[model samples]
Structure formats: C-alpha cells, structure tokens
Target: MNAISIKGLSVSYDRKTVLTNVYMDMEAGKLYGVLGPNGAGKSTLFKAILGLISSNTGQVLINGEPVEEQRKKMVYIPQKGEIDWQFPATVMDVVLMGRYPFKGIFQRLSQEDKNIALQALEDMGIANLRSRQIGELSGGQQQRVFIARALCQQADIFLLDEPFVGVDITTEKKIIEILKQLTDKGKTILVIHHDLSKVKDYFDKVILLNQWLVAYGDTEVTFTEENINRAYRGQLSILHRTTLD
Candidate 1:
C-alpha cells in the first residue's frame, strides 16, 4: 500500500523557497531514509507531511485519505536536540505520554494500559530506568526512552528525525535493532539521517534530497558515488555494504 503520497509539494517562508515542486510516494512495510545536507529542507518536508505547517501548494494524502484523518496511525520521534531536556518527568512518565490517544479528556489510565506502557519500556531496554528522571539520563538513554515512548503508541508508521544523533555507540546499535524489528513486523518507517557510513546498512532504501528530489530507490542503485556527490552538495558519498537484515 502507498502509505503517503506527496505531489507538487513546495514550501517557502518570506519568499525563500526551501523545497521546490517535490513529488514522492512512500510505500508501506519499508524503511526509507531521507538523506540531505544542512539546510536541505528535510525536516521541513517532514513537518509539511505531518501537517505541522501548512503548504502554499501541493496535496499530501495518507493511505488514500486526507492527512488529518490518517495522522492517527502516524508517530513522530523528533530530534533529541529538539526536546526540552530539563522537563521534570520520569522515564515511565514519558512513555505513558504515548498512550494519550487512548484516553478521553476525563478518562484515567487502566491497568492494561499501564502494563502495555511497561512492556514498551522493556522492549526499548529502558525498563530499569523507569523511575529515573528524564534529565538524569545519558544521551543514549534519552534516545531509548523517547523510542520507548513511541513504541507505546503502537502506530503503523514511525517518522523519526535524526534518531541516532547524540547517542553512544551502544545506544545507536540498540536503536537500529529496534528499527529492524519494526521492519520485521511490517511497519513503515521514515528516518532523516546524516551519517553516510552507516546509511546503506541501516536503511532499506534512500531518498537523496538537497532541496530537491535526487534519487529514490534501493541503496545499491541510488546511493552511487556520483549521485551522493551531486545530492550532498559536496565531496561526499554513501558507503554501501549490505542491508540491516
């Protein structure tokens, strides 16, 4: 199924165009990486897709429906740098926030909800840090906690921006493992990544972007030296080894 369809997409602020007439189809049950350099409008593209900002032109459809209704099945894990690190909340408390969709304005959490949240924490390997305050966690721990929060949502699609950034090697591996598991379960994933060395191994496909669509397909075909150099806006290339599977 086509999870998302974007056509003639364009976004600008104060007459400065960030993305030019872009069109793409994101398929279901696939892991797609959005590759771009700084100021490449990758994050802006995601925000537009999520309807965080209105686009002056183009139409974005999710699962053959308007974006608003289909957004319920979507989950977003923002960049760690974007989060308020000083928020006075515990690891468990953060994970519980993912369950907010299941609650009515006046409703309280049930025992089943609590158990599911705990299970999600465990799945992300943060069960031990349940009681720890969010600010006290290390860089890697913080990423895992955020991922745990997303897992608790159990959404069909996961959109993560710079998920592996500012984390330890161990934490990076754990996050990749969790992503692989999601792929195994047929969950569609879109991740904005900067690291070229690990891109081919971590992602099933790459969508090279630099304020425009460069290439969209398998890494073996699209992540070529010439393509990467052209899309990355410099002397850089995607290193290919093998898929995560």
Candidate 2:
C-alpha cells in the first residue's frame, strides 16, 4: 500500500480556494520534491496533509489509516525562517521535545529519552553544541538542530519545508546524505524545495504544483518542459529548456 494517499483535497481561506481537488499517492522509501512558484499553496498542502488545517473536501490517509491515527509515525520540520530564534531553549532541550509523543502530558523525560536526544545530535554532528542556547547557533547549525530533533522522533515519514534555505552548501549536502540513508532504511521523505538547479540530482520523484496538482511521478519523466510550463505559466520555460538540455 502507498505510505500516504490524498484524494480530492481542497482548502480555502475567506471563501477563496487555496488548494483544489488534489490527488496523490506517495510511495514509501523515496525522496519526493514538492515544487511550485510562490503562492502555489505548497505550504498549505503540507498543512492539509498533516491535518493541521481542515481540508474543505477530502481526506489524507497513511497506511490506510487517517493521519491523526498515525501521527507519531510522521515528523514535520518547518522552514527555519518561520521560527523565532530567541526562544529560550538549548539544543538538547529542542531535541528532547521529539520524545513528547512517547510520553504522556504529565510525564517527565526519562534518562533514556535524554540518551536518544544526545544520539540524534551526535548523528547530526552537533553533539558539541548540545548545551548551547538555540539562538546562539549559526543558521546551518540551527537547521542541524531541527533535523536532529526530527531524528529523535524516529519517524517513518519526514516532511521538511525548505530546509536548505539560508544553509551553507556543506549543510545542504549533509542533510541530503542523511535523507538518503533514511530512505534506504524504508523511510519516506518529502522536501519542499525551490532550487530548480538541484532538483534532478536530489529527488527520485517530483510533484509540481500551482494551486493544484500539475504533475507527479519519476523526476526524469514528470519534470518535463511542458508540465513545468503549465505550472509556471511559461515563465520558467527558458529555465526548463536550459536545465533539461
């Protein structure tokens, strides 16, 4: 069965439609790139999939079950720019939050949970910054901290929104490597990416969107000039021709 399925999904704000009649079935163990021009409802799509917002007319299922029933199996990393770096938390504290799903509301984090959080930081190559305040870290370091937190969740599906933005090239490479390792272990990863130059190298499958589903499938086949034109209204036609040449 597909790891995630969306059917007739729609969302609206102030009676104006933001997303419409979206349909897709995302398979397991692959890296998917969600692409679109600005205002294409990319973030809205992620929100709908996670059930963070009410969909106007459809459902999202994971492993044949509603998303709420399988919440623990998924982890979402929002764009760094959306966060407040001034939050009074340490790197370790942020990572430990991932274990909250395993602990009830009143339960304190156990030593084992601390251990997992440390391991996650180590895996991300930021163990040395465990005690540092989150706001003190550099942009790349901050992104690593978030990814480490997600790793501590040990989730089957990872949805990262524009993770590479403002990060250094080395950090981007490291993140991609970690994602590939996750897919090798049968995990599903979806990334909201805007860098068209790297799309061919980073994703095996790509979903192109512009307030709706434009195309989705193998990166090589679905990421074509014609489909990109339809989604971008021919604005990126030259880019498509140049990139695909």
* Top candidate by TM-score: 2
TM-scores of all candidate predictions against the true structure: 0.90, 0.95
lDDT of 2: 0.89
**Model 1 error, position 241 (Å):** 15
What would the per-residue lDDT of candidate 1 be over residues 1-245, giving only the tens digit for each residue?
A: 58888898988988998888889998887888898888888888888888887755898888878778876678888988888888889998899988898899999998888898999988877899999999899988888787777788877788899988888778788778888888788788899998777877888888888888888888778888777777866645333322221
Lowest-lDDT window of 10 residues in candidate 2?
Answer: 236-245
Name the TM-score of candidate 2. Answer: 0.95
After best superposition, candidate 1 residue 194: deviation in angstroms?
1.1
Clashing pairs in 1: none
Tell me the lDDT of candidate 1. 0.83
